[model samples]
Target: MPQEKPDLRNLAEPVRFKRALTLLLMTLVLPGSAQIAAGSKRAGRWAWRVIFGIVAIIVFLVLLSLVWRSGTINLLVSPKTLRLVQILLILLAIGWAALFVDAYRLGRPLTLERNHRLTASIVDGVLVVLVMSVLIYGSTIVSAQRDFVASVFGNGQKSKADKGRYNVLLLGGDSGADRIGTRPDSITMASVDAETGRTVLIGLPRNMAKIPFPAGTEMAKQFPHGFEWKNCGHDCYLNGVYTWAMGHKQFFPGVKEPGLLATSQAVEGITGMKVNYYVLIDIAGFQHLLDAVGGITVDVGKKVPIGGIGGPIKGYIQPGRNQHLDGYHAMWFARSRAGASDYERMTRQKCVMTAMLNQLSPQKVLTKFQAIASASKEVVQTNIPAGELGTFTDLALDSKKLPVSSFSPVPPLIHTGDPDFALVRTKVAEAISKSEALDKAASDGNGKKSNTPSKAPTKPATSGKPTGSPSKPSTDVDDVASICKA
Candidate 1:
């Protein structure tokens, strides 16, 4: 009875095997527990400190995000913070894997049966691989985000919100080997309320003539009258403003993007809204962006050509209801103008924009973040500062919940060939005023009966319609969702 005690290292095969598994399981759950229980207490204590420290930091960040969202986002987006996190993840992966190995040694695998030893080895190897793989993958994502933020933003000057709104000029730059340089094919100004996130999209036809430059600006001193090329005739239009400025870069001394600056000035002079920033999207890279989000769905009212502006028509995205389109077809849907008028094309472009805004959910973004980041780097060019990304991102998420109103000066409303600048400015002001009124009403809980149309105007005619033929163009739409709906 006095010799009943059994040695832990000399237990039966089944007992030894069970003990080995228990140690491995403990290491998996808490890296240093096995070490403290059976091995070096010093190493186990250090590992425990690191694990606790990491948990503390994570819990602090989570709490911070709940109370101060933008602050947390800024911390995450900071390049310095990202580098620190990446290094920490790598070290943590290595240290955690080492702890698992140490735990395996503490299990005394060699003392077990052959089958037991093999089983323990396999389980330890799997746990190490799984843990390391997750940490490494997270590090890669953080690295990609850091590179994306660095490359895409911070080139442009920072701007403050003018009054209660932020006006951003969105340009769709079209360039090819056939063309000499990039031209902004699509021009839209997204004016967002700084507080409520209420948004109004103001569109300018690419062919709009007589675009004026803001007073006291360099563009104003050069083009005092309006944007016009004498011999170019009708060829000189809003889109050509970029090409013209690029040719006259000397006028904008020390400016990085003279073309963009000049174009922004022109937009300011036309819309009478101060431009806070500009985002230029290369049309060629747009398809990649659409594909990254697994494509978008849109109601195609008329056929859209694949490639027919300068070349033969490759194909047509046939008209249908709730058509799910891949990157290629969606790009064509947004850019095609083969038989469609510019106004028709603009409507479709807005539809595509609305579809993207409504369809790109946060879940999709998290799952396809790598692909989206890669595509965005290639597709987007902006002057928006890296510091303001958190605010804008938060605003963007807020905007998704509200209706997006749109205004486009088209035929009957205004002549692109002989645009009335005074009338254009008036309409722009009216649209913004209406959006603000609706936002106020909604906030006051009295917006349900508001007269603003809830649906977007019907799609413009694409085929068998002459450029001058008047289509039913609503001067403004209160909700773009109706326009984009199937």
Candidate 2:
């Protein structure tokens, strides 16, 4: 009984194959375990220490995130932290692959039968590829995220929430070879409560004239009365402010983006709300984003024309329920004004936006993250700092569950040619107050609607033309859901 000392390096064929597979499994489960069992204890100990440290750090971060979400998110998104993560992942891939190789060596693969050797080799190769590929892919995603954060968000001074709310100007820029310069075709300020994420979207018609700039801004000093050009008749509009400011860069010395600054100031003056940040989206590139999420499903209320602003109409998004639109059609759905008034087009744009927000699930986002990230870089440019991304992202998630109210200074409510700035501000305040009251009522378990009525216009204006104003004055809609119906 004492004479039989079994050799691990030269075992029976079946036993040898079994041993080899066991070793590989051990390495797969916990890198270096196989090495410690059969090979060098020193290398295995080092590997184990590294793996344990990584796990401990990850656990600590998870716990920290539970208590300090924004800080953890900011730290993760930081350039240095991302770089460190990228390098660590690469190192882990290489090291873990090495461990698998070492485990194979410890299995004495050469001594096994030819068939057993082949089988062990295939299993070892698969485990290495499986482990290494995931780690490498993770590193790549992290790198992409770092690059995205750097390129999309500015390193601007952080803005605090103004009066328990953050007012962000969303500009849809329309720039083409046919135009002189980029003009903001869509101008909406999304005012969100800092706590509850209650939102009020204040839309200003691109054709709205007589836009005043904030008091201290240079634009205000230049145009003491309001935004106006000497002889630029209908061309001097709200959207043209961007192009105008770009042309007059001398007025905003030391400012990097004078156009955006001018526009934000104009929004502040119009809304009587502080402009905390601005996200300018290129309208043409917006299709890419819609395509990334596998397109969106919206209830198309009317036949939205594809292209007819300066060219012939290409096609139409026919009226339908639960209509699934690709990027191209969705872009046209949001931007088209052909055979439709500006206010009608604005309503359609809000519908598209709402549909996107409601339908874009977290699972879909994760699955299509790479495409979304790439498209977002192309579509969006924002003054919101990288540090505040986590906070705003949280708010956006909260906003999806809440009702979104919208107000536009269009038609009978306020004339685009000669807008009453005072009336516009009052409407803006009323919209915000209504949104807050709704949020409060929801929190208090009161589903009853606000009974307050808006101040109606004494003389409702009417227009005979298709592109002209509607007969009824525009009023604030408490919830966009009712308006965006199929």
Candidate 3:
């Protein structure tokens, strides 16, 4: 028996090299082809079937999107689907790894020359790594989405549009361990047309006092005329609504998010728009999110402070056009109020949002998906129903082509301290009308040029100075796409 031990060196030169090369090339072109060439043809046929099925499904989805965009997006973003996707990816990783091992087995590397066996092992190792890496990354995105969807949205019914519009209240809070409660420093209402997705941003000041609440809400009943903390003297600012409401949580009864609910009521009263949902984002935590998308590009109008609040001045963002900003600098770009008015800060924030929306292309999202998903989970908290997420996603994609116009109820237009509710409503209505009219005009223009697709939205010019008039400090409305154009 010992004498019968054979050596691969006995194989003919042609048989050794040709057979190994054929197997390696087969697997490279078709993952299971090596098995068909040497092992069970049935197994290889099944692998081919799976591969074809995956491609077919992807093609079907692409076609579905053209016909029923919202339905496709909804199905894609659904948390349940994401969970199933995670499971499928894990299974795929295992299955593909097995096919690779089987391909190497069919190569009969053990019976080849030492150099040929070494080459086979290296190729197999590389294939395994590439396959596993992609699967793991895909799994990470699904997991992140699952956790985020569970944490942020409820399993509530989809909300209906109000008068052909969906209004969402966006609140930015700068809370730290040292802080007693959250103070919503920035409040903005996004009124989006139900069909066209055209949006009008209404910025509200944090220092606004006597904010009116809805007629029958808890806060309305408590403050009757408006949100006034006369007992706390002059500290009853609009931003303090959350902190004040948190102290009186008993009044909210069974409300899960008492602070957010209270602020939504105040925002509804102030904007004269019924908010269907609210998103409370932590300003400090937003930096990580910016970094995840490889930072956002912004047209820095002025030299903005980096880190000056509750600490020494760190640095400044120099004025520039199309400046690429990281997490730390972008946070300051949106928030820094040092040597700048709050109105100016809001304008910068709006520009930042617009820049992010424009620059965050689909390719970038796919490549940095894991980081974006992880960062989003930490910063954003919302009451938007999970079922409606797909609809909003589709709307956002459609809205990208349309211009975004902004209106801030500041200074000469309407005093924040004693804002005229009637006048504010009128201005908001007019802004909405103007935005719709512009969209209609753009559509008509595009139709006239039927042979060509619509061009990118134009941006407004940028000046380092405040967006408002220097002499009178009046509210200014402009296209954000133009304002943040690179």
lDDT of each: 0.81, 0.81, 0.76
Which of the two, 1 or 3, has more lDDT?
A: 1
TM-score, cand. 3: 0.88
Which predicted model would earn the best TM-score?
A: 1
Clashing pairs in 1: none
Residue pairs in clash, model 2: none
Give one digit per residue, the lDDT tens place, for model 1 in 239-311. 9888888988898889878989989999999998999999999988899999999988777776678898779
Off by over 4 Å in 2: 1-6, 229-234, 442-474
Clashes of each: 0, 0, 4
Task: Return the lDDT, model 3, position 88.
Answer: 87
RMSD of each: 5.1, 6.3, 5.0
Candidate that beats the other on TM-score, 1 or 2, i.e. the better one: 1
Query: Residue 337 in model 3: shift from native, Å?
Result: 1.9
Clashes of 2: 0
